[model samples]
Target: MKPVLLSVLALSGLLSTSCRQTTSQAPSQAEINAIGLKRGSITMCGPAQGQKLGTASFGTSCPAAAQPDFNLALSLLHSFEYDEAEKVFARVIAREPGCAMAYWGVAMCSYHPLWTPPSPAELTKGAKAIALAQRLAGKTNREAAYIRALAAFYQDWNRTEHKVRALRFEQAMAAVHAQYPQDSEATLFYALALDAAADPADKTFVKQKKAGFLLQALYPGQPHHPGILHYLIHTYDYPELARLALPAARQYASVAPSSAHALHMPSHIFTRLGLWDECIASNRAATESARCYAASAGLPGHWDEELHGLDYLTYAYLQQGQNQLARAQWQYLDTIRRVSPVNFKVAYAYAAIPARYVLENRLWQQAAHLPRHPGPLDWQQYPWQAGIIHFTRALGQAHLGQPDSARREVAALRGLHSELVRQKDAYKATQVRIQLLAAEAWTLLAEGKAAAAEQRMRQATDLEDHTEKHPVTPGEVLPARELLADMLLQRHRPQEALAAYEANLIKHPNRLNGLRGAATAAAQSGETAKAARYRKQLRKLAPVAPNPEAAAAHLSSYRRP
Candidate 1:
């Protein structure tokens, strides 16, 4: 279940980031899939109703009367404000009934290139809009080219797979860019298509690098262009590329201060670099903006962006050693009465935020008993979200001298893993597999099969290291390497455990578990200097977590028969 919190990075990936809520009877299977189970997101008809979406200026062949609204719609489109953009495009169409580009804008709003493939209904809607534009015929060659470029995705909608169609769209956009080298909009959109169509498994990041270079060139010309900043951030949101994205990250919040999504976006880079302070601030603003807008708009409840922001804020505080602040986030979540735009993204946030709180704070019993969903949230649609609940329970049970109970959780994860695979959701399938491996590893350890447990943990880390975290999360529920280090220490191999902690810290710098585990392992291994350094770093960050759950976890770990 690629639920909320992730954005354009849902599949082709506008990275996801949260949800809020009321509950009802479960939707049928068909209804759930029609929502966002397979697709990345559902349309938010007026998500940004009262907010100020940032700027764009598209010189179009549109009538003068329609130009300003067209620019506003186009600007919103750049920011991934599909719902509002579509509405504005409709207004533009009303003003100039024959404006082919206005129809094209409607089609463009449905094309979430960075997100997962559209649902069947979404596909048909976009296809019909583009078909209308085609029939109307653009007044200028450039307008015609723009309409034709979007046509690539809709042409074979029924028969062609999403990625194949995405590539065709990218190719068509490339032609539009090559033909009109001076067209900045074409250049920018093409760059996005490159990142959107780029293979996630391609660690070389060849496409990302190229896309970044293109965005950089366009940045100076339109300094506050939301798309330019937003796409640049997305293009370089990689471990190796994060430092390069610092400028864009720092600029994004100010560029579109009124946009909850824009306010939240900078944290994506901050999270990658372990810049907890910036991350916390970003999410704070994002959550507040989202909540205010949702209330003013009189929506059912908080927007998904609000929940996504809270999830990140909680993570940042915990990483910064502000355990109490992290605790407060869940307190806020408890008060959510309902979530508007109920879909996968919101469902993901519902499952993940609470799980993160317990697991990160090491509240094993709490982790074990986490409710499947908030009363208002739907879980029947998202089996992968269910997988998270089971995985955390497995960890809690494994440490609490309940190996059989832990195994039961592991069994549930296996079933969920298979379900994700059957649905062809590769990202969530891999995530479930990672959880299954780690859960089974702990179960094996609890059963006194230490070597097998270590082997499984190692496999988990290997697989986890290969893929990027989904945009919805700040980081893993727990880094697999941290788990491996914990296992090493449990077996009394401090030197090996110290090595594992050191390696993980290199990739995920300054993580609370990484620092604490390293400090403990280094001291046990007689590396006093290394131990002191870690402790000093922790002290500089903040005090240790105030909760007693970590101590309780230790007691439970030792309770193994």
Candidate 2:
């Protein structure tokens, strides 16, 4: 019965193609129910309800008894609950002592392909797990093949470069995928490996596009597959491709409602498109979900996932001008810090929340008076997080007519840039340098050196234009180019300021400051037509109160529309 069921599943997978549109008809309820059944009894040979298909199956050569616990473990792995997945996979190993794939699950959790490279400790642990799997008896050829693919990822720690190792693992997965053309899990894992091996400097996103195509094909039959939707959101998490992923982003939370990351994933698209309402709702749900998970697990503090959601929530609230709500979130962040352990996520929020509150509200005096080392988190370890605080302080001090203090921050930023360069972190080095240039420009402007300030600010803006923000933080506290536009407006260069604001809108899209600056610069330049259009957009963004007629009359004077 198991063999027959396996054959039927393979045949069904073979009928699917990689080009099928997401809107194509989905599998029927009966067909889905039959996916993991043998002799009318549900088995754990494949994914069950809410479980993504993993590269493990029960068959003649692999005679380990099917247990629901194994499927639950795979589901947790798909949702990236690494700690939980590791424990559950251990249970599967204890029950089925010869299950080679159980060790594979443990190794995969440590890799964290999308987030960051494995730490040395994680690599050692994964290598040990793979060695154990290799010694297990009765492992099927396919199961051995799966283990071999992951072995390539954890093979050489001190010798091979990280990207070179990733490419090696990708090549192994490609071969596994070819060997089992009808295995949906093989295709899915191959797609992820392709994405993991993609060159970050290649803006064309060739590997990402290929992965997206495979996930799209898998979606028509397995519409609610958590891995497919989650990977799809990640593949298109850029300005140009975000809209194309709206369908997956919109459906993922519903498909895996129990997973906090699943709930949080949709907001990537929402943030990219500036869909503030949707972004707010998604992060709100995600925060609550993360809190509940932490509480149920009896953890001592709020999980990093909760802080991550709050970062997105705060950004959306500020964009919508809900300062009261944003301030409330800022207060909650301090509470979390008091109770939570200091980690990268906590440190990032510790810096970003205050930076956003002061800069977005334009409270220059408060920003200027901020502490040099504000929090207890190790600034030396996470210099990029520290850079946020210094950047804000520099901007505020310069704006408050304190050139000396601002210049001090400029020097500090240069030191930070030099430190990152020594650490061989090119991305953060570039980011800190951009901040240094902006700080210098603002300080020069405070000294009434308009021409020199413009030159420095333009250099900062041009460098910033070529780079994209890292995925770890929601965005920078404030964009440097936007500051350049503000400085241009102050210098009575309305035309250049308008162009700067327009370019910012292309990258940021519907940011409140960008919209407001573009409108004011247009009005000052006597571009009444453009001013009216921008004013109309502003009105749509935030409606005025207590004399709608007066507001309409003021805007009407700009154009005869």
Candidate 3:
């Protein structure tokens, strides 16, 4: 049995659970060869000098010949390099014809646990891969048990829901971990399975807490294990728990620097903690890594991973007031869009970069003057992308004293909202609706209906408060509640505006507009000390030039009054 096989079997519940006892005696060299582990026959795969992810044990049943290949493939799998792992696993199967684990690797690659549930076609593929693994005769009882566990994941193709299957798989993994207490890979995977089934709405993070405990316990012994660190980041991805994960986040990139996802994972914690400089550095490296990997691998379009990194990079740049850098990123994105294929990731960056740049820079006139369809990118495929553009345009128009234009944009946003509702995408529909309400408030403000504007903006903020930003995008162009606070400040309700900005900051920490608004509101409300503190923090975040005069001018540029 290969470690990749065991891990995948543990992940999918494909192996039988009939055997529970651990085998005390190790298999002989001849026996291992018979089972497909031919000593000295398999060579290590991939780049040889890259980071190692600790020792992998494929158990006594694995052929000594295939162990190196198996370990290399397992390491790639741990880093979520699915394509690379699949290729390595294919090499393993080619070298050891009876290796059941290689088939499991192929199957495992088809199921991306965190991103989305497996489609029916993927389930079908997984079923076939497991079936191939089941036919191999030399797998030990432990290996068979692992296969049975994976079988449970795809067992009833039509009956069980995805989440239910994930829960079942988690239970099966728990059994595997119990049977193999000494197996670090088994324990690491069991923790990941817990995360796979964790409820997104559960603020308590019950499953993640359990997973965190396991990973932390394993980390001391397997300090360089990619899965341990990667899973630790996932376990503490939320704002409340992110602090506990700082050590792991700081180390993961160095542990597997060759892996683009590894390079990018740290920023999740950095973004959560408002560590803008670190976030920028991590994403920059990740974007470059992605670019190099794509070029070397002969990929046609801009790698989605690269786009993902750019989104984070752009967000960090804007937050730090690096407007020129932020603008240059989108300008690069525009060039990439002209040459590369457009997917949802590309479409998202295409829409979000300009939106963030304009809104974060408070370029209301530029936003108002944006073309109906700004670029060559296809917006029809992703109406939410178009919705973002229109929302920002509406905000700009209303602020520029063009109420009629803003109202037209508002009407278009409502139509998009209705369309998303009809499409049964409640999440995106809600996002569009929030934009509609915010636009309506802005229009009211332009019309001098301060009370009506306040009510509408409050309603928009309330709606936005209930939902979180989608993971696909870095963050919103401008949080609706932040805009509400700005409106309140303009209406001379500084105390109320301060409260609103503070509330928004709790969720969206270190945002430029939120911090500035809170500072302004604090000063206006006579809390000079609090205002000074905020200004000091802002200067730290958005540092000025070395020249005193230039620094003063730059600082003044960001001030509202």
Candidate 4:
């Protein structure tokens, strides 16, 4: 929910999002059934893979036989199918051994534009691949320029930092784009690089706006090109810019129907704009596509991308007040035994999906009883993720009148915050600090210290407002501002609560609780017009009165009589 949301924070680990080792055996049946794949729509692109990777009309000076494979590799790269693209590029090399551009494709796969930093092993591999491309330099000037641009990143990767290398690559790509004004690939990659290199702290979004402008120029000419559509959605993923990419978000999946990532990418825009129905549809297809992808790759169970899709899907379902659908997804989540490519993204989805279920549904007992370490996962590996468990439990216990238990959870959160600070991971540490403040505030409230709780919750909201959420999460497990509003409502401060809810809605629009809280607070404060507006939004969201209990007890549990 940032102004420049594409800047990677947490969930950058999904499909274009993550990487780890592959599984050998076939996936289980439960995994297949949970994410129902459509068997009918198989002719996605061509006989090559039945995936519509979209057209990558690279004017490579290679043998005609190799050109088709080369184009396919480029298309796969655009969709962030790095390993698959590398294999196709290798096939091009086998067919035409001296094809230098194949090596360029291989190197290009190594440099993920908006995902996690390449590992040391990946850096070594990418360095060697680019060196080979340089050695077998092509005669085509455009091909040579492409290889040269990527070489800038691999040059000092051992000593220089990732951000520095990214800036260098962007600058180099800018030169290539300027030189080859007619090349759509050059325009697209450069725009992606601009997004990758854009500073997270820069609120003006200079680089993002520039990238969006460049991509929008090429969209009309290359509407079906998967990369153009994919990058366009990413470039404009911010709330302010999301509507501009709706057309692209609508079509990206069908263009590259076989790529789970392609199916999932559209939801980024949907989530930003609060189009709950569209978001639900997008992530459902995304989860199914990911399951189908893992099956095709011979993974043991599902890919981490499936977890990503599930988390987004659950969040969307919850927003529409569709708890039944969210709970069904929860049952499916409990069935996941192994994720083929686990990383931060996988960890986030696994942790967040369960937390969202309890907190959103207001199952305080479930939250209070949640295990500190959800087994099969190395809890110590991600302190920031661990904070989610502690944060949720603390809120639950506070609402349940168990101040002592909530304080213990708060202590654990503080410990994680300290550890993250010691590790000098400022981003994660800040998140933990926010959780600590929120948990402590609720604990204070439970102990009948209303003023202290109010002040601490306000601190939590202020700190959270300064930081942007990483792409891995749809939103906070529990927004600090929403909790503050809840506390205000419970204390009989309806006017103040209404103001807090209004501010929260501006930041996180169409959130079920935010809308509910606003409607409750407004009606109580005699603001009939404002109350009607919020109630109208909620009615549009859930016409059937999805959660009668949730609606009635929106503030009852925490209300101070």
Ranking by lDDT: 4, 1, 3, 2
lDDT of 3 at 125: 68
Candidate 1 regions with alpha-carbon error over 4 angstroms: 1-53, 551-561
Please list the residue runs of candidate 3 whose C-alpha ends up more than 4 Å from where it truly belongs after superposition: 1-60, 118-124, 152-165, 178-182, 338-343, 369-378, 411-437, 447-452, 545-561
lDDT of 3 at 247: 98
Across 58-170, the per-residue lDDT of candidate 2 in tens digits comes to 23232335356566666666767677667766666555545667767788877878765677777777776765565555656677677777876676655655666677677
The C-alpha stretches of model 4 lying farther than 4 A from their native spots are 1-49, 372-376, 422-424, 547-553
User: For candidate 1, lDDT tens digit of each residue in 334-448?
Assistant: 8886887776667777777788878876788888777776547657568877888999999988877689999889999999998888877788899899999999999999898
Whole-model Cα lDDT of every candidate shown, in order? 0.77, 0.72, 0.75, 0.79
Residue 411, candidate 4: how far off, in angstroms?
3.1
Number of residue pairs clashing in candidate 4, backbone atoms closer than 3 angstroms, sequence gap of 3 or more or interchain: 5
TM-score of model number 2 = 0.83
> If scored against the real structure, what TM-score would every candidate get?
0.88, 0.83, 0.82, 0.87
TM-score (C-alpha) between model 4 and the true structure: 0.87
Cα lDDT of model 4 by residue, 180-234, tens digit: 9999889988999999888665667789899999988998888889999999888
Pull out the clashing pairs in model 2.
none
Candidate 1 deviates by what RMSD? 8.7
- Candidate 3, run of 10 with poorest lDDT: 37-46
lDDT of 3 by residue, 1-561 (tens): 111223554544343342233443333335433333212222222235954444444653557888887787788788887767767776776667567777666667666676556767668767766656666667776676566667667767666667767776677778888988887877877898898878655668889899999999998888788888999998888767889999999999878777888899899888878899999999998898888776766667567788888889999988887877888898887767432334556777777888887777767777886653344466775777778888989988887778899999998888888888776656678888888899899888888787898899999998887665665666777889888888888777899989999998887788876887789899999999999999998899888422343334323333422
